[model samples]
Target: MEGWLGLLLLLVHNAAAAKMKIVEEPNSFGLNNPFLSHTNKLQPRTTPSPPSGPSHLFRLAGKCFSLVESTYKYEFCPFHNITQHEQTYRWNAYSGILGIWQEWEIENNTFTGMWMREGDACGAKNRQTKVLLVCGSSNKLEAVSEPSTCVYSMTFKTPLVCHPHSLLVYPTLNERLRRRWDEIEQSLSDELITEQGYRKLLREIFQEANYLKSTESKSEEKENQKGSKRFETLEQCSVANNELSEELKRLKSILDKNGISYKNASDKTVDHLVPSNPNAARAEERFHLRGDTGDRDDH
Candidate 1:
């Protein structure tokens, strides 16, 4: 009986060990750090305490991508009124080959973020604060912005000046709260933080992510609007070139009557053989009509 009981204990130990997995991740600097995956997924079991999340001064901001070429653009709208060409920008934050509009957070050297759970309940919706980690910070953090993936993130070359003051995954803090939760998991007699802590952190982040910061972006919209305008100017330049070429031809006929050639940039003596009209201040031909490369799009 003693040997049989010992065998049962060994089986249980092996089963428990298989439940928790540490995944090794390769980062930007090519270092591998281990991340622990939660064995049991937690669900939000209660309403937000403050209902409306807390107000924060700073906001989390990063790029959006449908497909990242130059500027991360995800949508294309061919509205002739909004400007000329089709405008490409980030489209859906819920579903794309790449992920969606992720709500990412940052603080100190630690980082954490979440992704949408793949299933029917969350299968369609972009992972809101309820479940999504855009990116995080930690001394041993890895950054990967990859091909065919919409990774919203921020990287601090140095550690954050101040540590984040919040519960990790109250609602769900990624790395920002991972360290705290790691400690809490040990303290709650092997359970992670209480339900109260998770909700508290969730509420805090919901409010925090929604706030407008002093470092807000008003220019990004203006800039995109400006980018669409250049395509319009390219059309105008084409018209201007045609008008100049026509007038130059008329002037050349007048000069030919007096047997003169005005073809070179450095030669200006042909002025003496021009017509006497007051407008004989001769309309100029574009001697250097350059080819249109879409350099105007840079502005």
Candidate 2:
């Protein structure tokens, strides 16, 4: 029995030594080890990487900002949704989702704004907001405006949106020139000036800086042309004034002949008879002066 016990103890010691050796041995395969295969099989829980670009507004993700304009309060959540609440005594006066996060607006390879879309409906289309991200010391919602029905624009300021040399005290030379060009284009579009006038203005812009100051250097012919333009303008004004006076006098004579007081007439009716523009007034005066004789002559 003692011999059997010694043999059993030796067997147990050998098994224990083998187990210890296996545990102490370094895993040469590292992750590929059969023992660690289960660990490798388990996929890692991936955390989303931060948004990449000069404007790192991803730091503001999941954060919210608010602004109040008049009776309405606007709430903006980065990488989320925007909402508007009407101020009232009740807990829920009027609440609406303005927009949902769509994508980042990129300009010049930099993130400049956030576009949110597909919100509450307005007419046939849905509401949307474009939040312009500007640099500031702290994150804030500056203002919210609905430039059109169901379309919203927001000015949002955050330090995260700031980039190297983003702000400027004044516009660049190119910007100023572009603005002037736009103004000239607008003038032409508004019919405030003719095509010929636009070209003249353009030429004046490109002329020497002292061109306006050197009026004395102009030729006599050019001076005479300028005087003619002025005289023509004055003559037109005088003609329009005379026509208006004659029309008024004629109306007054007729009213007196009928023994009707001018004061009793409706001002609107009088204004209707007297056209707003000189051309229209002239046409109206001619029509009245010719009367039935003109119609018979036309036939």
Candidate 3:
């Protein structure tokens, strides 16, 4: 009976060692091993977030603007979906959702329009609409029309989308100041601060901005005095003057050594001598006269 128990123990130990070896190296059993296959299938995956609308377009979010026509009324919500309604005497009946926000249509590094698709079915394919955003005094759904079968076009106008064409294109000084004033006004309108507080804030801003500062304000005179004090000591003034003189002398010596002579700087502003930002300046043609970049759509 002892001999039989010893043999049984030896057999149990051999079976455990073989099981451990298999567990340590699963590849030796081939890629068909169930344990290894299960682990390989359990990979971590990340879910992607939805795409975002442009800054100018995002400002109109949550507000639904409508355009009423003789037959139907159209509604649009920025960064959301659009819908059409049948104009009834009692209440506007829901026609159908025109389209949902998909992606932005960009041109020349600017978001010119938006593509809203996967909406109500027309016949075979689903409805789709292209919304064109333009600069205007206020937000309005200008118009809507069906260009092709089930394909629609919409024109939206808002001041928030107003921006210069390119980085090289700069707004006029009046436009810049107007935008600044609008920002201040918007703060007050939003009730972010009281009127008196905003006025005080404007005064502080004006004091900091050299060009905007009042001539009658003592702060302007103080700024002038501060600038003058940069060379308060005679020794400091002499050092600056000597440094400028030396720079000019060195520049002149180099020009003379190179056998190059230039006339004195012109008294005029010499605006023509300054290189243009865009060397080959091309004026944007009138919208009607321009070539069809395919962006043009009805309404």
Number of clashes recorded per candidate:
28, 0, 0
Cα deviation at 59, candidate 3, in Å, is: 1.8
**Number of residue pairs clashing in candidate 1, backbone atoms closer than 3 angstroms, sequence gap of 3 or more or interchain:** 28
Ranking by TM-score: 3, 2, 1
Give a tens-digit lDDT track for model 2, residues 3-54: 9999999999999988884446554343233443332332212222233223
RMSD of each: 26.7, 23.4, 24.9
- Model 3 stretches astray by more than 4 angstroms: 1-51, 89-94, 165-299
Candidates ranked, most accurate by lDDT first: 2, 3, 1
Best by lDDT: 2
lDDT of 3 by residue, 116-167 (tens): 7777777887787889987789999999999999899999888876766421
> Candidate 1 residues 82-178, lDDT tens each?
0011123222112122222223333322234322111113344322221222223422212324332222332222132233533232444347545
State the C-alpha lDDT per candidate. 0.32, 0.57, 0.56
Better of 1 and 2 by TM-score: 2
Model 3 C-alpha RMSD to native: 24.9
Q: Of 2 and 3, which scores higher on TM-score?
A: 3
